[model samples]
Target: MKDILVRSLTGVVFIALIIVGLTWNVWSAIAVMGLFVGLGLAEFYRIFQKENEGPERFTGITGGVLLFSGLCLTWLSWADQRIIWIPAVLGALPFVVMITELFRSKNNPIQNVSLSLFSWFYIVLPLFVLILLRGKANFPFEAIFPIGMLLIVWTNDTFAFLSGKFFGKTPLFPRLSPKKTWEGTVGGLLFSLLAGYLISYFSGLDLTFWLIAALIVAPAAIIGDLFESMMKRSLNIKDSGNILPGHGGILDRFDATFFAAPLFLILHFIYF
Candidate 1:
């Protein structure tokens, strides 16, 4: 009972943070997303860190923040074309990481360099895509794209759990995630469509767009969750980090967003 309360409370707070971050203002959006990229990279490096040799955490996190924030600010066009050069600075970071690895004399220089660079691609890029999705042209201050996209994703996650708990039988992917089931996936999909319909009704956005987004987000979310699970299992770790109390880490919480945001952006570009 205590655990359930803690989980519920944490979940509510987590959702509130994301909504506020995305919907409030440009700075808030940058700050909140930066926190995720910074912390998620930290956790990623920390988990894989080795005694003799490991990823360069400082360089990795710093570079990731600059890259994410720069792209975000650039897309928002808050600073005009001058700030466009901000993202350009990240071009040197790969060389910087590689150079730093030379002094460390790690057991595996290749591992350190590769892993450090990989975080930018895996963690930072997806988030920047989300900011791009939110910063779509001429929609005013309202962040309907991100809010609606996340709503459908969250709805899918919620119902999938409930459905699986009650009616799950055939394993969706027992190897990657034992708890998931075909019944749950279908339940989540159906509910996600309902969530999309509600969003369309309330926000007056296109119904076809929301419905298609639900379809893309559900499977993408499932894949994201399973991929992260595979990563953790391979590393022999339980959770990404202990930052979010009952919810585990930022990486664990936003796994769905990592995949869903980028795919939705593709749809956005093609649609618009």
Candidate 2:
């Protein structure tokens, strides 16, 4: 319990610093996301390492570096068409795997190649969108992009856990996550919608945009939560890492954002 409190508080503080830094300058935000991309890629590769058949040593490190480099290089573009960079990066990852596999033919080449590809798409690519969206200058509600989304996600998680503990009756997906319930899902949706409205009111966002965001984000957040839960269960691990007491790891904490950010970015670009 003490560990949970300490970890939560520390997380809030660190996140607050990142938000402030991001709102202040685009470069600062990119730097922060770049670091996260690196860390997240490392975690993904580490998980793959546990498979024992994958290229655990050199390929894992290479995947991490490539993931980070892709994000960093995308920022150099002046146009918002930066998402186009992803396919190019995706194309290169396989070549990297094949080259490495030829030299080190001791391991299963197919598993090694697949692991490299999966890490890029599953972990790094989604995070790249967060940096791109947050760094956009023309977006009127620029300051709220990262912070508001973070707040909504955190609030949804808190309410879901509390409501589930007290009032849960029906399960949402018992196999994937035994603890998540319909009551929790309802609670999270309500909180997320409320959060969306609050951001609209406080951050000068249009009600239309907020409504759209809420509709889009609430479910994506839930999907993200379940996705990570599946990952944990697959690996037979309780948490992604013990770095944060209640939160688990960087992956656990940011799982919702990984899905939500990309969803929001797509909606923002397409609709607004």
Task: List ranges where model 1 is wrong by over 4 Å.
Answer: 78-81, 136-141
- Clashing residue pair totals per candidate (backbone < 3 A): 0, 0
Q: What is the C-alpha RMSD of each candidate to the true structure, in Å?
A: 2.0, 3.3
lDDT tens digits, residue span 1-272, model 2: 88778877978876876676568666676677767766776667666565356565566566666666665665656466847866587467668777887777555778777767776677777766766767657343575776777777877888888989999999999999999999998998898889889988987778778777877787888899899899888878877766655567778878888888888888878876
lDDT scores for all predictions? Answer: 0.85, 0.75
Model 1, 59-174: lDDT tens digits are 88888888787677677775586675766676787898998888887788898898888888889998877677667443334678888988988999999989999999999999
**Cα deviation of 233, candidate 2, in Å:** 1.3
Q: What is the Cα-based lDDT of residue 208 in candidate 1?
A: 96
Can you give the lDDT of residue 202 in candidate 1?
Answer: 91
Q: Which pairs of residues collide in candidate 1?
A: none
